[model samples]
Target: MRMSMTDLEPSRVEPEERVVILDFGSQYGHLIARRVRELGVYSVVLPHHAPLAEILRHRPRGVILSGGPASVYEPGAPQCDPGLWQAGVPVLGICYGMQLMVHQLGGRVDRADHREYGPATLEVEEPGRLLAGLGPRVDVWMSHGDRVDALPPGFTVLARTAGSPYAAVEGGDGRWLGVQFHPEVAHTPRGREILANFLYRVCGCKGGWSMAEFVERAVPALRRQLAGARALCALSGGVDSAVAAALVHRAIGPRLICVFVDTGLLREGEVEEVRSIFTGLGMDLRVVDARDRFLAALDGLADPEAKRKAVGETFIRVFEEEARRLEAQVGAIPFLVQGTTYPDVIESGGGAAATIKSHHNVGGLPADLEFQLVEPLRDLFKDEVREVGRRLGLPPAIVDRQPFPGPGLAIRMIGPVTAERLQRLRACDRIVREEIRRAGLEDRLWQAFAVLTGTPTVGVMGDRRTYGEAVAVRAVTSDDGMTADWARLPYEVLDRIARRLANEVEGVNRVVYDVTSKPPATIEWE
Candidate 1:
């Protein structure tokens, strides 16, 4: 594999500029980081109370206070560390972040009689430095019940809406800016442009944070981290793990062992594809045939969550056994590498409640295990991981693999998993993937999976009434798995998938497409 110039760059070398986002438990906190990345600048989402020393360690060029589900007047509402205001970096606050900024700086906020929860028109009262390029009047997305009644001593209200008296504020010679509306969402018109203005004008940040640079910088650090340490990576054949395994291989060569477990719930041909890719990469590889183990452990499990937990726990037990055996032979315990990404960490919320999903990496680990964890892709999002994969010279087939749940087909099968049901769903899912690929839409989707609804529905085939399981094809496009919009598959593509699944896959009499986005419906029904 040929190495790109960017791949040779030092990973620890900080970017020319970065945006630090102080997360306040808002769902959009990660979205704020995504927006900054889209602007060609690196961003990290830290907890609201992250110490000033930790923030300074990143040497961020600017800071962003993310919106949250908190009211400034609430007694226990999240607050920023006092040292943040004096951090000397340009700061932009959104929604609750704005309210917190005001309240912290000696301003007053109150619950309003009329609350804005959707689209609103902001009339610019004063075109301050923050609103220099943004026009006089614009539309923005608003979702808040509280409003700032007054600004801090030196801060001036930059804009206001019908219901909000202090919709926007600027302070500290434009070093500090706050907006009552979210600029990260597309619904807010001119949001990206506004963010760009902040990046270039306010922060004076250089747009050097590209995936190319990331891969170049990360490789050597990954090499050092794995030096003299044998590593075992979980290869799910999905893009995340594939990229992770490939990158680690590039960094440490034979010291890295890629383990691909056949969970029996994977779609048709998935195991072979994973094996072929790892072998092709010339890395030490192990293909564990644990299909029966997974199926037996999951036998009679009807609840989706239960099936998921069972699959996760089973994987860890199997992996732990393998790790111990490998260690016994190799005379040293290896680092257990996982493809855990930022979205997983953020959605899991860095706390107990967020850790509900039995992540095979952290959640599934037994308390008695002793191997150290190695997660190279911990800081990257899914898209960035793919770019790094491409830079590492991995095959497009592996690098562009769609997102698959760790529980595999277990979660996709809505009821008790059975060999017959697995076959039916795999066939249906293959048809959907083939159709999407033929339409040249593979790269446009984050995930495209088929689910066996388990419930039999009445249908007619060959003029005969039949009852069989229903299959629903779900495809979504998302920057991060935190939020997603259902992909709008072309009618022809949908028609082809549905027709093929019904006609080709046995026990599937109905085929449907999931049109619901995240929130009302998660990407995975289970």
Candidate 2:
């Protein structure tokens, strides 16, 4: 079970004392790590079966076992290192992680008669260290089919739900704790309290880490890695890339050349806006018009994955062309800098986790990319990246910009990408953002944009029966991009958006709002 260097690569900026989160294949594995980081004690995620040596390598103050979808009894199910229990570090097992811990110990776990899969009330029985501050009855999110039926020796029940008797348990030296429900999700209102208790009370973390410290550490690391080599940064004008560019520029200064490519899939006036923003910062910025190239690559591609790959490959090719052109001016650029964040990496199958979707930058890149990727912000979340941007003195407009997909409007279009469809989506997307901003909810919501469903609907426009494309508007609120809830914009604002789309934007008849959350549906329709 020993890991190679690549498999054990540090995903984020290395913190001196961190909580090591073992990913057991849950979609929320990274979410668990994010929650720990939000507590100001840095965390790193590793595979569930990572060896004990590897776990100790992180100098973990605490180890959190993330919930997974697999049954522990199933053959080939992921298993933890048996030595972990005796390793002396505090361990908190969650969901399947709890089941595994119980099963590994002398405890017995069996399938519950009724599976607890949603919001449930946790009644504190003993109110031990884990549930000490929370009141008797606490709300929690549960998604487990199997429950702990019998406790191992020295283990005591802390809390219980109707469906789960041994919902929360503590055992052995006051360090080992287990919870059947997830404490990382938004559903658990005081989940942060529980995690903070674990970090500060149990693990004794100082909670001293900050994004400013990350910038201080990252600049020195970047300078050391790049030495004097010139780098071409992929500037998407979004928060991640902008922060990454600023950090890299701080490290390498004039040697960092930012290349902003106009994919034509972007919203209206984005190219000019990005150009102005970076040029004003005095970074050597290069703007390339690759609209036709991107459109050609995306032509006839309806599958979301296909379109993402096409766009991704074309972006690398364009960057390569730009690098070649600049090679004569600035000799031999060897590094390609991108704003690839932790969510992008996890979603694109970066670690041992499953791939929900292939982000254009992470999964969509060509196999034969020549330049070495310098993702300064790869270990960061969206919020953390913004903090780093502020620490690096980036403009408010760039740092606070909403999350935009690397594939841009191409993925927003449901069908084949065309010049006409791009224009249509751009207009609709702008109006949705404008209305959201006008409602004074720009900074409140995570992202607000319009999706071209590409489904034709018949409606009366100016008393004429006209069949045009249907557009779906999506607005969401989220802490990190890991989980999101549809934003409930005021009715007045939604009405204005709908009316504007119907009258002002060309060839739009129907407007619909997406109410689905992140688990059932992603923020993006595609």
Candidate 3:
């Protein structure tokens, strides 16, 4: 892929233009980063103990200390570089973070008389910089045992809850603030507003970063990196891959070959639909029908991780084969593009959590691969990817379709993946998709899929006893596929999906709706 002089121009950002969060291994560290991004300013998370020199290199406009489980007084607890506050950067601290600030700055902290776990009320003593526009009294999410007993020499009370006298405080320096409540999570009514106040007012950020700006930078960077080398993209037609492919295609033009891998486990007509969308938009497309290859490899692997690995390896093999075939025609395909997102990596053991499972691109790739991955959306979340897609002028239908796993229906098929089960699932899934679209709620959901539960249920079909597979319909609304809540689809829409699955699909005897959230149950059953 080659770019003209105009296309190759570099993108730049001024130092001191972004926010950074020092993660003390808080369960909510990523949430804090996401909240900052939602405010239209860039933010990043670093270990609480990250080098002050490294932190200063970003020339951050502001820094935030994420709440953690450790007590400030405990030995070996994560310690911040005291120079962080001394760096002349604005700082805000969350729950345990608040305690750490006070403890390190010469104030006392010990076990609280009454610990606040879930929710609490904060009464404002003074509307500090962080709490500028928020009213006198506001509800906040709190979870901590250690409380700040006294103010640091430069600190004064801003707000307090029943359990702690210094729930929120501001240092004599206008740049420092602390709150013993989680303002990152949605549970706090004015969490976003309070954070916005710190980000815009205290930090002096102009707040305009977005996925559009991201694409504007990425296209040029990819162009420079690839520098006329051939690229092969695994286009899954999902938001991530599509957006990734579109971005690379923009950078390299004809040098980018997009292959839509037909994993056979996909929903009915997905291959044709994807082909039409990309081809219509002028993408150089190659359709590989590898359904048999994928299904054969998934013969008896019941474990979800096994299935994910098998499918991921099979994907690499197919791409490697395609790369060899194209080698004679378009040089070497040095870079392989897959639309892998950050949350997927984090959930798959990239960030804080232990290994959940191998996200096909992150952990599931075969040890031997033909090309380096070009995942433009690796650091972005799902919603962010969608915005990038929209910026690239992809079809709304292609960009709006809720995400599907890279392993396809193999992961969605809980029991065993077979041609028969796949077909049955495809039929039920089609009904679910059609009904959701007909109800005009398709865009309202993050993802809605049909899963084939292993166990079969007995039912009387036209007076004859029949036993068939049970199916579960899952729909959720999530921002970045991080934390999700099950979509409260209208019962009338659910009724249509259930009725059609029971009558027309001919496979499912019972239909169940999954109401569980992500913590207890993932969006995909497998």
Candidate 4:
């Protein structure tokens, strides 16, 4: 059927050479797993209570014990299978994970009189294989309450900090290792290099997994699912929804209905651009302009969650009506596809971590909506999704499109979802993007957009005092959305962006740049 999502029966991705991470209920566990995968190795995180037999089934070349919130001596503290170490595989434990290992191997761990919660300096005493060439003193990130009182037999202290006598240890002739600090976090300066060293030098792992490999495996699996069925994908013009719909189009061919609901809250020229991009790929794209209806549903709503939920319900109604219209033309379309990623699932409380926010597509869907959901790129990150899109022959315009939230500019409007405010924010957003593109910084940026704070500031325009809405220009640089730093844009670019928004955008008089990082203020203000 000539498809862009392409075809293949996904072959097994090295269960033998994989690094199996044991999760002990730490929020950082998944981050640890992601760090390992970024090292170009196949890695998976299993529940802390996973059976010993299940652990052996992966036939892992190495194992990592993730940090947890619980102390090692708590009554119901999570514990690894004692046989886990007996498996004779190399292991590296972090934080609570390190404490658990010490207790298991006949060492004492107790609550410390002084708990280390942030940064600490480590003095590398022995410079063991793990700490080789790490210099005389290493700055490490520490977040733990328990300290190892004594080392287990046959273990040597590689590094030590002021708060804890033991910070890093090595035993079993370099086969076993533990660290009190978390190397998965960005706060730890040498985290990535250390993980890479473990993967390449210690475990002797060869990375064979790529996003292209994922594409080959997923295409055929999707084809098998939609063999004779007609599926409808919800298109948001963002990377996730676009990639999801395009992949399904490659599988189902003419049997796919790609519905794009234009809620009038999208950026300038977005609706037209989206339709043109999809149709250029020979996709059966359907554009539904239910913007008035969406604004109507969100009328008088001020809270972010309330506005998001309203938008979600309205989107379902629009899609349902669109589905009915499509069903009339083509016999029946039953499957509904979405590009809900792993971070979305985890942030929406579908993973081990608590709910951070409700994504409109994943968590904001109405309970009574009537369609089967199909998400092909559910497990990939944003960068991974872009790679799959490239392999599917999607042009850079779509593949490299900066990620937009599911609720569109409705969430960015920061106030009532009226057409007036939508237009203002859209204009400001357009100027921000145009200036970034003009400076040739668009490709390097993670996201660059204008967020309307819905607050007005006074300005003198041609010697006349005027009050108008203020827009904050947000630009960030990030490998993933998990953590981000504000992009240090050049003064020339910033000056141009600010000057254009004030001069060109009608209702915008004040333009401000957000300098806060992700830890304190999210990239998206709302």
* lDDT to native, each model: 0.81, 0.88, 0.84, 0.82
Compared with the true structure, what per-residue lDDT tens digits does model 3 show for residues 213-247?
78778888889878889889999988888888999
In angstroms, give how far residue 10 of model 4 lies from its true place. Answer: 15
Tens-digit lDDT string for candidate 2 (151-246): 889999999999999989999877999999999988888888898888988898998778878987888888888889999999999999899999
Q: Please, what are the lDDT tens digits per residue for candidate 4 over residues 1-526?
A: 1112223112122334688888887644778877887777778667777877888898887888899888898899988889988889889988888898899998889999988999999888987667776788888899987899998999889889999788999887888899998889888898787777677777888876677767776778788776689988899889998898878888778888888888888888888898888898898888888877988899999888888788877887788778888777887776788888867766666534656677787678776666666788766778888888998888998888788988888888777778788877888888899989999999888999998898989999999999998889999988768668999999999999999999998888998899988766666776
Alpha-carbon RMSD to native, per candidate: 5.0, 3.0, 4.2, 4.8
Greater-lDDT candidate between 1 and 4: 4
Top candidate by lDDT: 2
Worst 10 residues of 2 by lDDT: 1-10
Residue pairs with colliding backbones in model 4 are none
- The full ranking of all candidates by lDDT, starting with the best, is 2, 3, 4, 1
The residue-level lDDT of candidate 4 at 349 comes to: 65
Candidate 1 — what's its lDDT? 0.81
Give the per-residue lDDT digits (tens) of candidate 1, residues 377-414.
Answer: 87787878888888889888877777888788888888
Q: TM-score for all predictions? A: 0.90, 0.94, 0.91, 0.85
**Model 3 lDDT-worst window of ten:** 5-14
Given candidate 2, what's the lDDT at residue 370?
A: 66
Q: What is the lDDT of residue 87 in candidate 2?
A: 93
**Alpha-carbon runs more than 4 Å astray in model 1:** 1-17, 351-358, 460-465
